[model samples]
Structure formats: structure tokens, C-alpha cells
Target: MSGVPTGSSGDLENKDILSYVALGDSFTEGMSDPYPDSDSVPNGRYRGWADRVAEHLADHVSEVRYANLAVRGRLIAQIRDEQVPRAVEMSPDLITLCAGGNDIIRPGSDPDKVVEIFESMIAELRSTGARVVIFTGFDTNWQPVMRHLRGKIATYNMHMRSVADRYGCDVVDVWSMRILDDQRAWNWDRLHLSSEGHRRLALRVCEVLDLPVDDDWNRPWPPPEPRGWRSARQEDLHWAREFLVPWIGRRLTGRSSGDGVSPKRPELQRCERYRPGD
Candidate 1:
């Protein structure tokens, strides 16, 4: 849908999404998707869909202001109480909010409660008069261990469609993006998207926003090499060591990946990566 509602000038196409604010958890913070000069991942410099979406807009419009307040490992409540107020203060022209993933995964958390709180937060953002871009949780049918949360994720996504419609917001429908279903689209951790996943997510956001972009999020991936049972088992063990362990540790200790981190770009500016040449 065009960013702006039916208008005399139809300006959503021509007008720049001058001010953009992204608020959520690691998904919005761009985890596992490192930037060229990425710092201690917690420093939050990873360039994910929000940043890429901003750059796409900056390319078309004269200027665009963007800020990302997302922090990895944050629950839905923290995002609502902390990031939402800051985002509303910014009064961005465009806002992308993708939280609740953290909550849905917690052992005892209720997906419905998470969505309830999440929608309320979105309403608060909508009150700012900014066009909100929402996302349904991705399908994780490929990840065996993560399958337990699949039902919860699906529940959240199902409610999300109606919630987005109620808010007049754009839904990116990550669940329906078949391209992301590919194993290559995900990082080794299987919990977060890889760089390619982020790129595709950026494309999907541009599509929803009705912006001009050349890339296709649905482009096919090359054939994969066959893996024997032993190697597959080894890969699973390594994944548990590298990603799952730390994730569970964080949940147990009450520490966060973004505990002391700040947004890479607190204010909007031209995305240098998009500029001509390095």
C-alpha cells in the first residue's frame, strides 16, 4: 500500500519517508547481520532491514531521518515502555515495530498476552500519526528444535494480520515470504536471519512501502551441498554451543545483548553505504 492515505496529490510515492524510527527487539536491532565495521555485536551497528529500508528511501528522496532504538533480547514490555516513548518523541514519518518474538519463545510466556501488549504498543505509535510497518513472525519449519515455538509464532502472526488492519499499518508478512524459508537465508544460529535474510527483508519492506528498489527478495538460492547424518549432527551441536546456549544463558541471568548498547544512528542522515562508490 502507498504510505500515505488517499490524497489529492498522492504524495506517498513522491514524498520521502523523511523521518523513520524502528523499535523492537533483536530482529529490529539487526542481530547476526553485521555491518562492515560492526562493533561488539551489542554495540548495535548491524545493518538490518530498518537501516536498509531507510537507505532505500534516502536514495529516492532528498533526505531521510532514521533512528533505531531496538535492542537485542528485549521482551515486548521493555520495548513498549522504553522504546515507544522515545519513538513517539521523535515523531518519525515512518515507524517499523517488530517485537514479541522474545516473549513468545520464553518457556512459560503466553503468545496471546504478548500480542495484546504488542498491539497496544503499536496503537501508541499510531497515535503519533506515523505510518507503521508491522511484521508477522517468520515460519521456522526447517529448524527442528525451534519447532516447539512454531505454534506460538503462528498464533502471533495470525492475530497480527487483523491487528495491522485495525491500525491502518503495513504488514510485511514475513511468514509468507517463501524466500526466507531457505536454510541459506538464515544464519547458522537458526534463530536470526543472516545478511542475505536482512537484504531480503529490506526488499519486502520496500515492497510494502511502495518504494522503488531493484532487488528481489524472492530470488532463488543456488543448490545446496548434501550433508551426511554425522555432519548434520555436528552442525546441530555447534549451533547449540554458539547460539542456543548463549540465548538460554541470557534468559536465565536476566542480562541482555543490548544492555549497554546504543543505536548506531540516533538521528537520520544519508546512508553512506548507499552513496556512490565505497
Candidate 2:
């Protein structure tokens, strides 16, 4: 669908966007990425796609207020119950919602129920008359045990598309990127996206928002070196020990990696530029 034109939409001219709020889980919180220690980036803020998008918007647009309400390891329900209220109160001109990834990946998850809850959240956010941007969950085609959840992810993506249609919101189709299926796009955990992966996501979102961008994230990378079976098995064992085991234990104990974590950009303020030249 064509996006809303900035000219007659009354959303601030390209130079005067007031506020932009982002809401979601680890994907939005930018789990694997680190916040730079410079003045440009907030101390310990995850420079994830949401922040990346905000940086770009701030460069082209002026007085742009940005807030990231995302927290890592949050469920769709938690986002709806927790983040939705603040986002509604903020009532920014633009808002991004990228939840439900954590729910679809878990065992015994019901895609229909997840979609219902997600749609409800989107509906609530849309009521504020903000331009809501949503994302599809990528498939874990390269991961061994996680690949089985691909069908559930696909089901959730379909629901997201439907919600975007019903709510007149924008959808970033991350699931069909194909590049994300490659192991290189993932971090050591094999669940979260690497820094490069987040970069590509920022570009894709820029396209969805009808913003100018230099990189074409759809381009595939050069062929990777093939690993021997023994090496592959050893790497898999290490990943299971370091990431998978701990993730499972936390789930069993009802603990989350983001239990005490708060958002990096909790308030709507001027966003600093990130590598503007690039």
C-alpha cells in the first residue's frame, strides 16, 4: 500500500517531526547490539533498528522527539499491558510496534491467540492517530532446533499483514528477506540478529516508511566457507551450552533476560545522529 504523504497529511513537514515512539521486545530493544559510549549515543543504549531509524529521521527531519519503549525478552502480552500505556500517553506523530516474536518461538504457542492479542494492541495504538509501523518475525531456517518454529512465525506474519491492512499501518516484511535465513545475519545466540542484521533491518524499515536510503539490504552476501561436520557439531554444542541452555532454564523458572532492564530512550527527546556519513 502507498504510504501517507507528508505534505498534506498535517504530520509536520519533513523538517519538523515532533515525536516518534517505538515499542516491542528484544528485536526493538536491540539485544545483541550495544549502545556506544559516546555523547551521540545514549550511554548503554542498544543501537537497534528502531534507534537506527530514529537517527536517520533526525538527520533529515528537525526537532524530532524519539522514545524507545522496547525491552528485551518481553512477551506480546507484556508489551500490550506495559508499553502500550506509555506509548498512548506520549501520543507521538509516529510509533513503531514489533512484538509477538518471543511468543511465536516458544513451545505450545497458539498463533491465532498471539495474532488476536497483537491485533488488539495495534488497534489500541492506532486509535491515537499515529503512524504505526509493524514488523514480521523472521524465520529461523538456519538454526537447527529453532527451525521447527518457522511455521508458527509464518502464521504470525500473516496475521501481522492482516492487522496492517485493517488498521492502515505500515508493515516491514522481515520474514521474506531470505538473507535473514543465513547464519551470518544472526549473532552467537542464533536467536537474535547480529549488528549487520540490524543494519539491514533499518534499511528495510526506511523503505517501508518511504525514507531515502543508500543501501539495498536485499542483496545477498558472498558465499561463506563450508565447515566440516565435526566443527559444525562443536559449534552447535557451544551454542547450546552458552545460549540455548540458559534460555530454557530461564523459561522453566519464569525468569527473563530483561527482568530489571529499562528502555534506553525512555522519554521523547532529540535523537542523536549515528554514522551520518555512511
Candidate 3:
């Protein structure tokens, strides 16, 4: 990998990854970012960064099989139990895992404990002789409520780096991506990335894979519109009511946004440009 730090044992000598399996939570599942001309997909399917990256890979190679086994509101344990084993069975040449964010943001959750589970998943994936990549928690300092969880996120990110090093895995360091600091990079809910944000992330992931991309993920944004104190507070209240409260309620009720959701592309298929209906 050119820009991404790698472990001693795993290296991508060939950029031509034949098969890729994406495993993780909402971020990997593509929350908030909708498909073109559709607010939602056939079955809550989201064309997230992982899908975009798969499409990019398909662009260069003759064929690349891909599957995204991610669902929203999944805890670290759920991912480890449900996704990791399936990925290993698929035996893909490349895998990208971004778990534990849901667990980390919860009250009283331990980053050390989360990483322990995370490391186990990576160890199992590496056992299949597959190249693995992991994503770090994003720096959430840009949002007021999310900023409160920054310490926990930072702690988890540190452990993630160490685990990647030990496993010889590649890393997508979202914590250091300053481009996401802009508000436009996030969806209106302020929880997941916007379409533009996902696009940028796709570019970053390609770069990490040593894949050629025409766009720059680090491009600067125009100046943000200045908001008065009262306006800012009103917006915050709206966000809380619209997004934060529902999220908290789900946690309290032990319900998930993905309670009955199934993985969009559960089976490995030839990567193709995501059309509106597909």
C-alpha cells in the first residue's frame, strides 16, 4: 500500500483483488447515503463506500467479485459472530472490516474489550490467507453531541492501529481525514456520511489499496455559512429531536434500526456500477 500503513506479514503484491468481502456496521452498510434518484433501496440496501470501492476495482480489472455483509445498528459482537465467519468461508482475496463503533459509542463500553473481540476477528480472517483492511473510528469532534464520545473513539482508534500492525493488515485511517470536518461531508442526521462524503471515502480506500483514482479525497471545501448562536442552537435542537432521540430510544428498548434487515449483497457477485433500481 502506498499511503496506508501495513503489517509485516500482509502486503498486496498484486492490486488485482479477485474477490472482496466487506464486513462491518452501518458505516460499511452505507447509512444516510442514498442511491441516485431513490431515498431508499429495495430492501434498505445502501450503496456505501464499500460498494463504490468495489465498482472502482471492477473498472480496472476484467472482473472482481464482491459482497457487502454489513447491516446498520450492529454491535461488535454481532459482526464478529455473524459476518467474520461468513467472510472466511467465502475465502476472498481481500476483506475490509470496520466494526466496534456501535459498541464504543455505548455507555460503559470498554475500548480494550472491544479491540479484543476485533483482534480475534482479524486473526480468523488472516488465517484464510486473505488480505484484511480495517477502518478506524472517525474523529467526531465536528458534532456537538458526538464530540462527547471523542475520547472513547480516539481510544478505540489507537487500539485499531496497533491491531492492524500486529495482524499485518491495511488501515483506512478515518481519524486523520480532515476533509470530513466539513459539515457538508455528513448527512443531515449528522450520524453518517453524505453521498459526497462516501464518494471521498471510496477514493481514500482506493488509494490505500494502491489503486489509481482520478479524484482527490483531500480536496478543500468552500467556506461554511456563518450561523448565529441562536440559529446554531435551534439546528442542534432539531437534530436532537430528529436523530439523537430516536437513536437513544433504540438503545433503551434493545431494538435496532436493522432489527429485520438483511445484507444487501449477501452473495458474492460480479461488481457493477450501481444503477438506481438495482
Candidate 4:
């Protein structure tokens, strides 16, 4: 969609938006899609949920300057080190965070650490006087594997809820909203979301951002079915057993590991170099 429609009947007009920042991992970066033109590199510009959110905001709000600093395969530490600093520097009026999935998938990483990082991030965001939005949910394909880590997810979400309550920020319950036991909402990799999944997520984010949802926005633009679906049960389990499990084992055992894995990229021309003063 081009821009998000405000629920109002007026023509699309820019509002006096100060600024907004989006920070997180692959999910926030829209890992599966091709990156936008503005990115410094192909990988740098994946059109994830952050892009969707920004587009929607642009349609309805006239005066917003939105910057998405999300990266694929970013863990909590990586976000803290890279994304958060840039976001804080922007001094945004609004901020959205969608992360922790990679951390959960990482070997040897404690789920508690995820919660701790989220809490710290929220605290820091609040200190900046920005209205914060936190997204909570996981793709259905990962649910089975996440079952072991469900408790940790719950705890992390609970912590987020408490922080939001204390700080008067918005919390989007995306997890309960999008995940359904009967349907598959993930891609073949069983990690990234399907296009339909991204649309669903974008709509929910629109709601949280208080943007208007049009018929097009709610119509499931990509259509979930006819694309064919996979039963999470029928998928290969060897990857989890051979790759993920062992990787996590090594992480827990204090072996140095790189960021979990790079995501698949669409073929595209490399963008111009990102210069601070370009």
C-alpha cells in the first residue's frame, strides 16, 4: 500500500509529526522482502514491518520523519549496541520495538536475557520522553520449537506489559493476535513470515499506532491461501536437531558464535555507499 489512511474522511494530508524511530531485528526489517531504494546496501534495506508501519504513518500523518534502524539477525546486544544509539540520537517522538525472536532462536542464550534487554530498552526509551510501542508475538511455524521457550516469552511480555503500564506506553498484543494453531503463518524457512503474515502484522501495527484501517488494509492484500501451506509438523526437523540445537549447545557451552545466520536476500543492485554527510 502507498500510505496508511487515517480513519477520517478527509483527504490524505501530512500532519505535524516530529519524528519516529523503529528498532529491532529481522521481523522489524521485513527480512523476506527486497530492500527499499533508500538503503545503503541491499541487505540494509529489507522492507520489513518497520517499512510498513512507516508507509501507513505517512499516508495518514503529514509531518512525520520516520527512520527504521532494524537489521536482520540482530540479537538483543546488537540492538543495544547499534540500533538504540541511532534511535536515541534521532530523539524521536514515537518509537516501535520488535525484537527478541533471534535471541530466542540463538543457542545458549537465556530467555531471561531477552526480557532483561527489553526492560532496559523500554526504560531507556521512556527516559527519552517518546511514546513507545512494543510488539509481542511469534510466527506460528516457530510455535512448536518455541514451546520450550514459551515461559520465557511470557515472562518477557509480562515485563513489557508492566513497563508499558508504568510508563503509559502502548503495547500491541501481536503474539495472541496473529498466531493460530490451525494455520501456518511462516515461510518455508519456518523463520520469516509469509507476505500474508506481514500484511496481518502491518494491520495490527496500524491499529496500535492509531492509524485508520481501510478496506484494502484489512482485505488481506496478499491472500494467505492458494499460495499453498505447509503443516509445521511435516516440515524437516533435522535443521533444528542438527543445526539449531547444536548451535545453541555450543553457545551455552561458551563457544564463540557469529550472529545466528544471515537471511536470504533478493537479487538487486547494490545501493550507493552510506556516507554520514552524503
Q: Single out the weakest 10-residue window by summed lDDT for candidate 1.
A: 1-10
**What lDDT does the true structure give each of the candidates?**
0.79, 0.82, 0.86, 0.61
Query: Candidate 2's error at 156, in angstroms?
Result: 1.6
In model 2, which runs have C-alpha deviations exceeding 4 angstroms? 1-15, 36-43, 276-278
Tally clashes: model 4: 8
Q: In model 2, where is the ten-residue run with the lowest total lDDT?
A: 1-10
Ranking of models by lDDT: 3, 2, 1, 4
| Per-residue lDDT of candidate 4, residues 11-127 (tens digit) | 223345546677877777675654434454353545655666666666666555667666665778888877777677777777888777767655566766677787777667767
Best candidate (score: lDDT): 3
lDDT of 2 by residue, 1-278 (tens): 12323221233436465698999988898767665553542344567788888887876787778999898889999999989999999988988998888888788999999999998887778877788888888767767687788888888888888878877888888877888887888888887888888888999988888788888988888899988999988999999999889999999999998888888878898887876423
Candidate 1 local Cα displacement, residue 114, angstroms:
1.2
Q: Indicate the TM-score of model 3.
A: 0.91
Candidate 1: tens digits of C-alpha lDDT, residues 129-206 = 788888888887877787778888998898887778777778888888888888888888887888888988898888
- What's the TM-score of every candidate structure? 0.90, 0.90, 0.91, 0.70
For candidate 3, the lDDT comes to: 0.86
Please provide the root mean square deviation of candidate 4 (C-alpha atoms, Å).
8.7
Ranking by TM-score: 3, 2, 1, 4
Higher-scoring candidate on TM-score, 2 or 3: 3
Q: Scored by Cα lDDT, where does model 2 land?
A: 0.82
Q: Which number leads on TM-score? A: 3
Candidate 4 Cα outliers beyond 4 Å, as residue runs: 1-14, 35-42, 107-109, 139-142, 178-184, 216-278
Per-residue CA lDDT of model 3 for 1-278, tens digit only, reads 23332343333434455788999888999986777776457466578899999988887776789999999889999999999889988989889999999999999999999999998888888877787888989898887777899999999999989988877888999999999989999988998998889999999999998889998999898888888999988988999899899999999999998888999888899887665543
